[model samples]
Structures are given as C-alpha cells and as structure tokens.
Target: MELISDDAPKSLELENISRRFGNTYAVRELSLSIAPGEVICLVGHSGCGKTSLLRIIAGIDTADRGVIRIRGEYVAGPSRFVEPEMRNIGFVFQDYALFPHLTVEQNVLFGLRNLPRQDARTKAMAMIARVGLTHLTSRHPHMLSGGEQQRVALARALAPGTDILLMDEPFSNLDRGLREQMRDDTLSLLRSMGTTVVMVTHDPEEALSAGDRVVLMRAGEIVQQGSGYELFHSPNSRYAADFFTAFNKVQGIYRNGQIHTPIGAFPSARQLREESQAVAYIRPSDITVTTAQSGLSGRIVQRVLLGEIEQLAVKLDGLEEPICVRSLDHRPPDTGEVGISIRSEAVLTFPNP
Candidate 1:
C-alpha cells in the first residue's frame, strides 16, 4: 500500500465543539478533522468524552456548541441539527445490536424497510455476500459466532450506502484471538471500500496499529493527536507517554548542565535553568543490567518472565524507589546485589513542580 499524504481533504471537520451534562462538561471545546478514507481512532479512559464526541458526530446526541461538516457541507451547528437517519452515516454499536428475532437477511434489510420489496432484497443480499455472510443469511443472530454476528451488524450498517462509518468498540465482545482477526478483517474491508471511519477505543495497541491517525483524549479535552509512530516517540505530555507505553520515572536535580539522580550524574540534552528540580523518564528497555563494576549499583528485587521479554524490578542505591527494566534475555541476578546502568540517550526529563 502506498503511504497516505498529510494534505488530503476527504475529511470530517469539527470546530469549537462542546457538550455538557448539567454541571459537568462531557466534551470541552474540541476541534479536529479526519481525512477521507482515514481510520481515526479516538482513545481515552471511560467517561473521557470519546464516546460523547462520536455520538455527536453520529447525530445521536447534540453538541452544546460547534460546527460539524462532512465533506465541506455543514451538518451540525448551534442553530442547525441533522437527524441521525438523514445524515447518511452508518453506525456499528458495541453490542453488535442485532435483533435476535430477525434472521440475518431480515436484520440486514431492516434499514431498507421504506424501499420497494424487490430492491430491498437485492441490496440486502448483495451486502450479505459482501460481508461473507451469504451462507448464513437464513440463520438468526444466536446461531453465529461473535465474529459472524459482528459482520452481520456491519453489513446492516453498510447496506444504507453510507460512505461514513462510526463504530463504538465494535470488537470488545469478542475473545482476544477473535478480536484481533476481526479488527484486521474489518479494517481491510473498510479500506477496500474507501470508507471514512471514526472509531472509539480505549486500547492503546489497537489505536496504534489500526488507525491512520490516533487522537488521545483526557478529561473531556484532546491531549495529543498524531500518527502512531510520532506520538510513541515524541509525546508532549507525561500522561501521553505513560498511557501509550511503560516508563520508569526518577526524581533528580539539574546543576551545571548535568542531572544528579539516584542512578548517577548524566549530561543534559539542553541547558537547564539554575538549580531546577525535574523528573526523568526512561523506558524499561533503555536500562542495561550487567555485572561490570563501572555502572551504578542496584539490587534485583523481583523478576517476572513474560513471553518475549522478562521484567526486572531493581532497587538502586541512593534512590528509595524501585525501577522496572525489560530484557529479551533473562539472566537472573542475586536479589541483594545487582548492578544496572541507564542509557544516556534514552533519558527524558520533565520540569518538576
């Protein structure tokens, strides 16, 4: 697949959007644009407004203030609101939202009730085949696997000929292995159709691997938005860094262009203001453990063997806290005496309050 450029404009635009629930703000003055054919995943903890924003876009909920435009035509604003059915948008709910009493074909054709009987049957059958459910069209929702039921919901949503798709944790109900397979398959189908999608998920790995762009939300506001690689390597805030990956933090002080921490004195990346306190963050992969006498001293406290890597907890001299380090090769060290070293380039410092 060719790389997608940043300048493309097949986009969903939201400007100055806000939603409130009486005294509490659900979404606070948010603004963003998702490109055409782009799978933009909204990620945050529960009650962080990610779902609320998606609901607003789907016309299921009204925004307190803002303008929403799809392909440059205004669809939502303070004085104007489009009904959910007229928005020409498809929605896949978290629970699969299939009617238990209806057959697969009937469920798929449910949205086409107003159309002529022959036309609705033709469209529903075509969608069933498109979703690889033609063989099970006569069966009810309970007769299918979790993944199959999810496809039925997807086909039903796509039957309406909508280019925009909104999904809310569509795979949460599936088992782990099935969830991964469904995610890949769903993404492939949507991309093949050039469908623009906005999905809400709290999983970081899912957001990183499945989205063309990832938006990280916290407490009703967008904290960071960027491509997966960019956000992983260059997070602008501690929350983003901690949320996306594991990091070990150490308190230290900067003096004379170097930081003095429990580990040791290390050169700073940039000149620091005089006598400033700071927090240094380093990923578990960045620390190296060795028996060499030249490195900082620490004691191995615990060792946990994960499939691909082993996590070690170490208590260092002069540092009261324990730090975690991950290694692909596991070499058990003595619990009370093991030396560890910090890589100079992997250290990230933040201003201390």
Candidate 2:
C-alpha cells in the first residue's frame, strides 16, 4: 500500500452530537476526537448507539444536534451537511455486502467511479492484489469463502481515494480462526496505509486488542474512552467494570471503610457510608482456588472447561450464589472445591444497586 499523502489530515471531531427517535435517544450528547491515521473501536451491547454514531460519522445518518468535522472542516451541523458519497469515506459492513453478481475485480472498480475506466481498473486490480485476492479477482462473491468475500469487501472500500474508513462488526461473522487472521490482516493493512478508521463492535476482546483507543458506549452515551489497559484496569463506573470483565458480585454491609464477605474482608472507599450496603466486584482471575480445606470452605459445584483457564463455581456455606474463579491451576474435571482466596487489589466496591 502506498501513502495517500504525507500532508493529508483526516482527523474526525464530534462535538456534543445527539440523535433521537421519539422518546429514545440513539446517540446522546457525545463528543470525541480521532487523530489522523488512528484506529478507534467503539464497543457496547446492542442499542448502545455505537452503530448510530458510526453512521453519523460516515454521513449515512445525520445528528440532530452538534457538529461533525472532518479534517477541521464542518461536514454536518445546523448550517452545513455533506452527503455520504461526497465525504470520501469508506464503509465495510458486517455482512461484507459484496454484490453477488459482480466479480471481485468489478466490485472494487465500483468504488473508483470518479476516475477514467482504465484508471479505475488499474486501481481496482491493485487493491485486489493488496488484499491478496489477485488470483481470485474473477470469482463472484457467492463462490468465495467467508474470509475471501470479506477481503473483497475491504478492497472495494479502500480502492477509492477515501480519507477515513468505517467498519461495523467487520469480522463478527467469521469463525474464530478466520476472525483472528482477518483482524491481524486488517490492522496490518491499515497501519501500512495510515488509514483513519473507526470501527464498531460488540466484542470486548476485539476492542481491547485491535484498536489504538477503545470507546465504550452505553445507552447512547460514551461511558469511557482510552487505551484498552486504561479502560480495563481503571474503569470509572460499575457498569463499565461489568462490561469489560466478568465479575463475581458479593454483597456486604459497608462499615469503617471495609466490607466483610463470605470470601474475605476487602477494603472499601471511604466515601461508602458506614453500615450501608455495598457490593464487591471480584474478577474471576483474582480468586484463588486451593485444596487446603482450611480457608473459607467451599465445594466445587460446577466446572467450566476453557482452553487456557478453568472456570469453577464454588458454593459457600452461607452464600446463595456460587463464587466463580478462573484459574490456570490444573484440576481434575470432577475435583471437589476446597478453599477460596480473594485478591484485594482486584476487588472493586460500589454501593449496592
């Protein structure tokens, strides 16, 4: 891939943007900035407005309020609006969206309409080669595998002189193996070309590993935006914590800046009023499992087989729900539980909801 221009600036800026339908807000007062050539991933569950925000940025959907700027130029707002086709933005859909009747080469050529026919063909074939699809350029979408069709879709999107690219769950449809391969390929390709990209995905792991920055959205609003490490380790809200990592919630009465639970006593923030109910969010990875039988007694009621880690459910003497622990310690499939140890630093305490 060749550079579009060293001086090209295609940074995106969204200022207090909002879009609503009837009483529901699809995108709330959201503001974000993306530097040129940065890849950002928007993540949340369904109805979180990630796709809505992506469409608004691509000019496929208009925001009801606030400004949308591309390279410091106002594209959508009260006074100005740019149509989708004129924005020089490329979009790759989750389904690949390749025309079944068109060959891979023709599908890529479709994006280079502004150029002469010969120029379009040259660029189209170049893009196909860039995506490693030169050998299958004549194949139709229906004849290609899931990953191949996706590459064709990607080539088509990038074939034009697009400044920014948007992808919505681009690899969600592929199997696990194919998804991982495509992810590495896509990121490598984008970095080589320095393409500015904003992708929306529901997969938390993908958002964590793929993007330069991850933006977590909830209820049409951005909950947090930062590096994956920042969001995972320093989440500001309980919702944010629960979204990024699975936690075993335990309820306790907060007093004197600490909460006692069935597992153990963990410190709470001073702001938590004494004697008030609090909940401790403990990550499964932090919980230690032992066969000592001397600590907090529990029995393994269920065991889940994950490739690298064993997820075990322990039923405490008095607690109703089993505490979950993910451990690398090898255990027999039918082994009984013994002891539980909770790591203090991994525990997050919040007011009971």
Candidate 3:
C-alpha cells in the first residue's frame, strides 16, 4: 500500500463525451476540464443527464463516443477502457450503497482488497476513525443512523486514497437541518484532504455554495460553466437566469438600451432591436420599497410572512398582475401606497417570446 505520489497527475478531463439510450442521447458531445483539487458541481432539472454523465465517468456506463482522462491517464477512449476497480476513482452514490450485512469496518476494507490482511484492517480502522465512527466499527448498516451511514460510505470510498471522488446528491436523503450539517462536515473533510471532486446535484443553493465551479446542463448539453457567482449574476441565457431563483418578470419594450415597463424603466445589457418586446427579470429581493414620493408609486395589496423574510405584492397602475417584493424588515408596511425601485445592476433582460 503506497501513498499517492505528490507528483502524480491530479486533473480530470473529458473530451466529447457522449452517451445514448436507444434513440435518445443521455449525454451529448460534452467536454470539461477539472483542475487539481477543484470541486465541480453538475446541476440541472430531472432527466437533464447529470447522473448519466457521472456514471460514464465512473465506468459504470459506457460512453458512445468520447475520451475520459483521470490523473492525466486515458481511462476511456476508442482503443482502451479501464475497469472501475482499476481507475483509482471513488464514487459515493445517492443512497450510500452500503452492504446491509457488512459491518462498518468490513465495508471500508472492501476497497483495500489488494492490500495484505493486517494492512487492510489497519487502513480501514484509520479511515473509520477519521470519520469519527471508530466506536461504531462493528455496527451493521441497519443499526446506524443516516448520517452515520453517510460517514461509513465516505470512509469506504476514501479508504484506498483514490485520485478523484464523485458524489450524486449525497445529502439529499437527510432532513433539512441534518442535510446542512452533513454537507458542511463532508466539505470540511474533503478540503482537508485536498481531493478533486465532481458532484451531481439538483439543488441550486447547494450547487452555488458547495462547488468551486458549477456546470449547468440542459437536455444533454452544458448551458453554462463558471463560478457560482458568475452563473447567478451573469447568466448567459434566459434558461440560466430562471434556474437559480424566482423572478418578477416584467414585460416591456426595448429601446435605447433600456426596458420600459408599466411601472418604470430599467437598463438592460442585452442587445435588441429598437422597440422590440423584451422582458426584464428582477429578483424579489432586488426591488426596494420606498416612501410614496421616491420611486414608482404602487399600493401594497398583499403580504405574506416567511420567517425572517416578508413577501409583499404591490399593484401598479398598468400591470395585469401585482409585482412581488421580498424584504427583510421585520415589520414592513403592509397596507400603504409605496414607491418601488429596482436595482439596475441586478436586472436580467431577454427578448420576449
């Protein structure tokens, strides 16, 4: 059993990876490069092919056309294919996938089969301890809590010192509180180990907060790839803009680099023909409620309290529906006429359908 060489290649590269099931393509001609020790999240709606792509990278599913290189060595290509066990990559499935009959210690030892008996046990115990589950090493999967089972799964996947780790919605099964805690704990461990990771998640907030880079996919192709802030703040398409959060879509006319809506005019960065119909997307949080004389005058017609945040629906003169505003003020005015102003920098515009 040897430690990973410091000079070993640490990047994962996929070039033109494609997979098809019958007449439908699960993954199109997709290509991405992951740097050493970088964490990348794949996010999209259901049936968007994120899981299919992960399986292809793991060697569980074959790619119809493409190249996969791990640690700078070709693992899947035209003339060569490496077995899953030989690829030195670890996978943590969504369900954890622990053997029901095996004890925690035995499960961790499964990945170190090639090592000598004593060495395998020693390494497995060390990993179990690293996950803070040393006291439960003899416990079977049925007897452990979900978080404990998650730790066991992580210990097993990491026991062999694999080059890259892949996770598919690893924390989705836990409760909200537990999910957040487990995610933070797992991230801390991965950061300390400096492991390169590729995670697939349908959760937008998780994708934004957890990954060094986020890859957003749609219908078997990547729509955008960049830091979370870049994708959220500077989305390339209307689809990308609508994916991250809720928006108050205002229909307007595009003229002179601005969108003129019923209530007010907002600047747009999108190029459009003059007088063309455009839609401005403003986040609920980006709308400011002011005194009656400050901005566009509107009457608050509805209010809903959402824990620390409050949602207010303001009815303007020309709009068919009231515009929603989210505010952090504990006791916001719920029944008065108010002025509304939008943040120009946060506005996203697209050509109306």
Candidate 4:
C-alpha cells in the first residue's frame, strides 16, 4: 500500500450531533473528533444508538441536529448536509453486503466505476492482491469462507481509495479463533495504509485490542472515551466499569475515607463526600483466595473451570451477594468453605443512589 499524503487532512469530527426517530432519540447530543490515521471503536449494548451514530457519520442517516466536519471541512450541520457518496467514506456492512451475482473482482471494481475502466480494473486487482484474495478473484461470494468473504468486502470498501473507513460489526459472523485472526489482520491492513477507521462493536475485547482509542457509548451518549488501559484502570462511571469487564459491585457507606460494607471496612482512595452511599467495584481477578484462616469468610457455592482461569463463586457472610473470584491455579477450597481477600488498590468506588 502506498503512503497517504501527509498534507491531506484525514480527521473526522462530530460536533454536538443528534439523531431522532419520531418519539425516540437514537443518538442524543454526541460529539467526538478522530485524528488522521487513528482508529476509534464505538462500543455499547444493542439499542444504545451505536449503530445509529455510525450511520449518521456515514451520511446514511440524517442527524436531527449538529455539525460534522471531515478534514476540517463542514459536511453536516443545522443548515447543510452532504450526500453519502460525496463524503468519500468507505463502509463495510455487517452482512458483508457483497453483490451475490458479481465476481470478487467485479465486486471490488464496482466502487471504482467513476474512474477509467482500465484504471478501475487495475485498482481492483491491486486491492484483491493486498487482501490476499487474488486466487479467488473469479469466484462468487457463496464460494468463499466467512473470513474470505469479509476480506473481499473490506477490499471492495477500500478500493475507492477513501481515507475514511467505517466498519459495522465486521467480524461478528466468524468463530472465536477466526474473529481474532481477522481482527488482527484487518488492523494490520488499516495501519499499513494509514487509513482513518471507525468500527462499531459490542465486544469489549475487540474494541480494546483493535482501536487506538475506545469510545464507550450508552443511552445515545458517550459515557467514556480513552485508551484501553486508561478506561480499564480508571473508569469514570459504573456503566463503563461493568461494560468493560466483569465486576462485583458491593454497596456500602463511606466515612472518613473508608468504606464500611458487609465484607469488611476497607480504606478507599476514591474521593467521596463524608457519610456518602457508594458502590465498591472489584474485578473478579483482583480477589485472591488463600488457605490462611484470617480473611473474609465465605462458602464456595460453585466452581467453573475456564481454560486459562478458574472462576469461583463464594457467598460471603452477612452479604447477600455472591462474590466471584478468578485464578489461574485450580486449587479451590471445598465447596463448603473458602477464604478470600480483596486487594485494596484494585477497588473502585462509585456514588450510590
């Protein structure tokens, strides 16, 4: 792939954008800017407006309000709107969306039709080779594997030489291993081409690993946006923490910089008002099980052996909630009794209603 022009602007900016469907607000007052060659992943649960937001960005859906700028040029706003084709954005749909009757080469070349026939054919062949699908150029979509079909779809989207690529659930159809492989491969391709990409996914792991930054969305608004490490280590909201990973929320009261809960009184680093109700979040991995007598007393209710780690559900004394702990070693105590300690530094506190 050829290097993109440094002088060319590759930024995609959304300023106070909002979209609605009659009585329902699909996306409510959202704003974010993506830099040139940067990959941003939008993640949230279904009906959270992630797809609607993406469609608005792609110019497929008109926003009810706000401005969109591509490379510093205004595209959409209160008084103006740009057509989808005029925006020069490449889109990969969830279903591959490949033309069933067209050959792989023809499908890729379809986007380049505005160019000279010979030049369009040349670009299509180059994209096919770049995606490692040259061998299946004459094949139809039905003949290829899921991964191959996805690659063809990607090639078709990229064939237009658009600097911006938007992919919606691109890897959802693949198996676990294949999904990972495709994600890695797709990232490699995008980075190599210096393509500015915004992909929408509900998978936390995929969003964390694939994008330069992850934008966590909920209820038609952006709840958190940061690097994977930043968001994982210090999430701003309970929604972000729970969405990113499995966490146990223990409700308690905060007093004198300490949280008093059924498990035990523990010092909290999180800033909180005095005598405030709060929820302490502890990731399953942060809890440690020890054979020592002195620790939080609990009864092991269940043990599940995952390949890389074992998950134990322990019912702590005086606490109705079951605390979950994960460990690599399978030396779990008997189902009747277990002792576990919460790591002080790993705890996160959130305001309780």
Task: State the lDDT of candidate 4 residue by residue for 135-248, as single tens digits.
Answer: 999999999999999999999999998888999999999999999999999989899999999999999999988878889998899999888887888899888888889898
| Candidate 2 lDDT over residue span 1-353, tens digit each | 12235355548989999999999999999998887889899999999999999999989899999999888889999999999988888999999888889988889988888899999998998889999998998899989999999899999999996768999999999999999999999889988998999999999999999988999999999999888888887788898998999998998888877887765689865368778888988898988886656667888889988998889998988789988889899676775758877789768888887
Off by over 4 Å in 3: 1-10
- TM-score for candidate 1, residues paired by index: 0.92
Tens digits of per-residue lDDT for model 1, 1-353: 23555476756899989999998889999998877788999998899999999999999999999999887778899778889898888999999899999999999999999899999999999989988999999999999999999999999999988889999999989999999999999999999999999999999999999988899999789999888887787787778888899888888898887777877776766566768997787899989887747577877888898978999998887777789989887775457676677887767766675
Query: Residue 120's C-alpha lDDT in candidate 4?
Result: 98
Cα-lDDT of candidate 3: 0.91
Of the candidates numbered 1 and 2, which has the greater TM-score value?
Answer: 2
Which candidate wins on TM-score? Answer: 3
Task: Give TM per candidate.
Answer: 0.92, 0.93, 0.95, 0.94
- Per-candidate local distance difference test: 0.88, 0.88, 0.91, 0.89
* Cα TM-score of candidate 3: 0.95
lDDT of 4 at 308: 92
Least accurate stretch of 10 residues (summed lDDT) in model 4? 1-10
Name the better of 2 and 3 by lDDT.
3
RMSD of each: 2.4, 3.7, 3.9, 3.3
lDDT of 3 at 39: 86
